[model samples]
Target: MDLLKFITAGSVDDGKSTLIGRLLYDTDSILDDQLEAIQRANRKNDDGTLDLAILTDGLKAEREQGITIDVAYKYFHTEKRKFIIADTPGHIQYTRNMVTGASNADLAIILIDARKGVVEQTRRHSFLVSLLAIPNILVCINKMDMVDYDKAVFDKIQADYERLTKNMNSTQVDYIPVSALKGDNIAMRSPNTPWYDGKPLLEFLETVEVNQQPEVQQARFPVQWVIRPQTAELPDYRGYAGRVVGGSFAVGDRIVALPSGVASTITRIELASESLTTAESGASVIIHLADDIDISRGDMLVKAGEQPVLSQSFESDICWMDTRPLDVNQTYLLQQHGKTTKVKIQDIVYRIDIETLERTASDGFGLNDIGRIQFKCADPLAFDRYAFNKANGGAILIDTRNNLTVAALMISEPVDH
Candidate 1:
């Protein structure tokens, strides 16, 4: 079974957790001990109801506050596929946490309360998901039970959301109506809303095609470590080890080490208990070179014909994470993959208005603000556009003094020459 990773996002009290808990419970994914524990807790509660939300609200503070403060991950499986769900917080204050959770997700399931109908938080998260370039989006209009499962209500919400998404860059969008509490149209077809004849949420998830092509326009492999075994068993063994950020590498392929620009041919590819001829994106393997080259941690290996832009200056879209305002001329450490370097903000072009989708001319950015900015690194860095390659295009800025992550960046454009 293939593994599928997805994220859940919506406004507070939209039953995001309940939907997930229902999906797991109804599918028989929960263990017997877990069900028994939940039953005991349900009996002790004053409401005397199951409170299925308790299955995911495992934290003491979460139960007391009745809101998810952090990203909660849940794992379950069906006969057809394996699932990894990231239950991200919906409150505005936890926007940074949401970004962290959705960074690696293949799809995003955005929920909206049928009665509420496209609230501010919904727009905020939708914009973020688009900015992150998440390929697939499933907009689930939840809590249909409260609205009498009205078809008109679902259509209105869908129309409003469609108008909003028209300006965004998301490639795929799907709409579904569900009542998470009663398990209507979640794991099974709902008789309550016979007007809707689409596949259930579980079926949609199992059948969604998530195969993505490797970003091969620019080959990149940031060296994590230099593997060396100097014992008598196999002396003079030197290998460059790292995960492929973009493209593939095969034995005997010509490669160029960046910053030094030394040429070499791939002599071997090594993995645990196996030797492979080729390696693709997301695979960690040690590569042996035909020539003795000076390469170390923080250096990158790329195909000689497809070299990435190496620049000291670049522009990026940044999601500010720190409470303190961003300042021009201030220095921070930019970390990408295994490479880290000191960088300074050259300027802030503009801040994006999530609701209006407009760029407001702003000199500074506050927490949770998304803006376009220019950066100057201490040295030239290899990179590709975020749309082309997520691993090579993403970066994090850290405050030097406090060592706190202040910004999450996506490379928008690279400076030529």
Candidate 2:
């Protein structure tokens, strides 16, 4: 089964967690013991249903507050697909946590209460998921049970959402009216809304197409480590080890290693003990080159004619996670493609209004703030624009004193020289 990584986001009480729990429950992905434990807790929703939200509110603090604070990840597999679901907090204060969970997701399940229509959080999360460039969005209008599964409510909310997101970056948007708590239109279509017609959540998830696979795009092999089994027999063997992030690499293909820009041909590729002729993206393997040049971590291997942007300065879109606002004078460590280098902020272009997607002049960013900023690295780094290749274009900022990751960066176009 193919794997799909998605996230759930909405306002608190919008049923994000409940939607996840229902998807798991209806798919029979939950263990009997797990279900029994939830039942044993004796917590019941106001509608007299077993509190399925407890299935994902694993943290006691979360259960106590009836709110999710940290990103809760759940894994399950059905016959059609394997899934990684990130249930993120919906509170504005926990916005950083939501960004962290959404960073690597292929799709987002942005929830809305049928009774509440589109609230402020609906706008906030919509802007965020769009900023993150999450390819697909399943905007699940949840809590239809509370609204009596009214088609008018669903249609109005869906219309409002479409108008609001008309300018957002989300490429594909799908809507499903569901009652997550009551399992209505989740696994099977609910008959309560005779005027509505759409596939259940599970059915859509099982078949949604996401073309974010790296192997099928341009090839990128960022060097992570150098492997030299210094044993007696393998003294001459040297292999570059890393995960293939894009395209495919095959034996005898002409390749170039960047920063140094050395040209070489692949001698062999090995995944574990098995030797292979080609390695696709997402594969972790040791690549032996025909030429033993000075290859090291941070170097990128690409097809001879294919090269990523190599520069010391570039434009970056950042979602700051630090509580202490950004300091213009501070130097940070830019970690990208498994390599770290000293970096400093060159300029802050503008601050984006997460709620309205507005661009305005800004001094700096604070916690959960999003901005377009320029950065200068100590060394030239090879990268593609995040829109072109997500694997090579992503980076993080870390404080040198404490090594705390303070920002997530998505490299956009390079700054004009």
Q: How far is 402's C-alpha from truth in model 1 (Å)?
A: 0.7
lDDT of 2 by residue, 273-391 (tens): 89999998899999999988998888889999988889999998888987788998999999997789999888999988766677889988998888799988899989999877777
Q: Candidate 1, clashing residue pairs?
A: none
Q: On residues 160-234, what C-alpha lDDT tens digit does candidate 1 reach at each position?
A: 999989878855889889998878898889999999989899999998878553445566889999988898986
lDDT of 2 at 46: 87
Model 1 TM-score relative to the real fold: 0.93
Estimate TM-scores for all models: 0.93, 0.93
Model 2 accuracy (lDDT, Cα): 0.86
Instruction: Locate the minimum summed-lDDT window of 10 residues in model 1.
Output: 42-51
- Cα lDDT listed for each candidate: 0.86, 0.86
Among all candidates shown, the one with the greatest lDDT: 1
Q: Looking at candidate 2, what is the lDDT of residue 393?
A: 85
